[model samples]
Target: MDSRVFRGGRGFAYLEEQDRFLGGTQAPEMSFGFIGCGMMGQEHMRNAQLVGRASLGGVYDPAPKSVDCALEIAARAKGTTKPRVYASLEEACADPSTDALIVATPNFTHLDVMRVATRYNKAIFLEKPIATTVSDALEVCRLAANHTQPVRVGLQYRYKAVYAEAMEEVFGRQSVGRVCSVNMLEHRFPFLDKVGQWNKFNAYTGGTLIEKCCHYFDLMNLFAGGAPEQVFASGSQAVNFRNFAYDNQQADGLDQAQVVVNYDNGVIGGFSLSMFVPGAREELVVCGDAGRLHTVEQAQLGSENQNHLEVWAGESGRSRSSAPTYPSYIAKAGHHGATFYEHLAFVEDLVSGKATGPSLADAFWSVVVGAAAQTSIDKRTAIDIADVLPVTDDIQDLMLCGAGL
Candidate 1:
């Protein structure tokens, strides 16, 4: 760990600035109150230690085991301060020593938690999907937009160096020369057991697309240059057939998803997820007229996702010529690496004033697209993004343009 990694201070300048902005003083080493100290929350605590700036001021979880797991992680931490346990989400958010709140609670309870955290003007690091529905997501964003504190979503893929580099290739260097189309193939395992088994139902998690594939949808939006028209999807429960039975019923969860996005700029993006496959290769391909970039990746996370960008010139096809290998830096055998970088950016924003990162609109639309797709699947028709998001005179509106409302 470098000595001068994240510390940039002038005697509580960040706190004063934060106070001036949000009407509450925030510490330089931002203190976080954990609203849900379950599996993902524990991951956040471990990664918070990796960032080395935040203090775990307090933790609150209904489950005793979850709280214990959080404390166990904190006990092993190096620079991070030990956190106190609390009985409720409000208790944790109300702690004066805390500057921000980390809401890793269940999907349905997200806005319920945010409703409290927003009142305190505490910065927040909320996990993805924002909420189980678009209206709920919009309602929270509407509230947070009025609040003074900064809010960052848990979209860790954007923070990965390899992901950034790949984006750079398509957009930065124009190596791909105006990405015209994008496609992602994600074959993964069925739902693992949650502490409460809430994720097994679509009502709680907003369907498998919103719960899981929001990450990929986010990246697709980026590759599509934020221009979205309409979305259509079809899914089935064929693979996880055993889990859909009475006692083990995963009634609301879909085992397969095939989604296509039609961009206003004529860029088409497609996403497919299959949980039935024994072994599946996860890959993303971004293509343009000049050339293309492709990454053959492993779907099961953890471990540095060691993958290469297969660069091809002229066009993307079986007949196209392959030349010049763009190998990504191989990652060490580790799982928490992505979380650490994302948390660093979030904490760094807390300490050194907010800079551009994942926006509320980004979080909003990612879920909007997925939820709309699920609707499309159910209705058997293409649904417009605006039908879910309801466009207004806003940047978010500008982002989701193309197919007429």
Candidate 2:
């Protein structure tokens, strides 16, 4: 097992040299095939190119226009060879040279794409949430477990340095002095305006909570350091888009919602989400007895764009001493999106046999908690995570793996 690390401006590339690429010759570029050529798909392609030593094998999208878009983007980017366009996923997956596949399709189609890729024995980069329901998500996980290669889900926030540092400080060092409660607020434009009607429907996106707030729920679980014991939430379409005009309205989706969760370790978690806010703020404020930590808010950029972290410790009966400001790289100057960094990490893990971020099971359970929050809102009751789905040893093990990865 030969391991060599390559350092570049973007980040470190850990490569494991193998017999397949010996003989005093360089290995062929890793070939990647993408299933969907939508916004996220294009970003993945660009990132793979930027990371270098990777090739675009083929791109498949149901929409011919999306194929054209992918081809055009590939033409403009450096280090990207011409990519073959396929009308169906089968054609893309059938390419023998395609080393791995990325699935960025609609929510309901994740399982189908993953199942096919697993059958082909290919590594996978799937966007979250893994599935709309717990049963389907679990089945996907089962299929992944049977696969010969790694199955990585795109939860890029886990890859950010700030989040990593914060987790180490809060959980590892116990700097937070037993997290008492967490208050989180995420504001953005509506889902329908951005993702169309499918996202607005309950059948497709699994309502706003499951589709959108799963990230926060996952983060809450990470900070609380355990599975939530209970959840109570209340929400409504208080600002229906149909009643408002685009000129005066912010977005067309859920206006406001709030959820309160209780962790098994006695930590309380509070979350508020709104699509009507004037601007975006994906910020988290973590308060502990020793100090409070705030994640710096910045715009999304290429793979490197990330939020900064600042911590303040209570001293002399008052808060004093602030953590130093970390650098922020939220967006790249060009059209390339931020998801590419995450996609490259997925590919790097596959080649080097490293554990990938956000496993399928972790993404699945995030949706589970999000679904439970919706249940609480609809029933006007406090929903326990176990009540919705029994907290088995499997869930706990999955959480541990997710946190460390």
Q: Global lDDT for candidate 2? A: 0.69
In candidate 2, position 168 carries an lDDT of 74
What CA root-mean-square deviation does each model show from the true structure?
Answer: 7.8, 6.8
- lDDT values, one for every candidate: 0.74, 0.69
How do the residues 166-214 of candidate 2 rate in per-residue lDDT, one tens digit apiece?
A: 7776777666676877777887656544334456556677667877787
**Position 204, candidate 1: lDDT:** 87
Off by over 4 Å in 1: 1-28, 78-81, 241-250, 299-305, 314-336, 390-405
Per-residue lDDT tens digits for candidate 1, residues 250-308, read 56688898999998899999998988665545678998887888876554444334445
- TM per candidate comes to 0.83, 0.80
Leading candidate by TM-score: 1
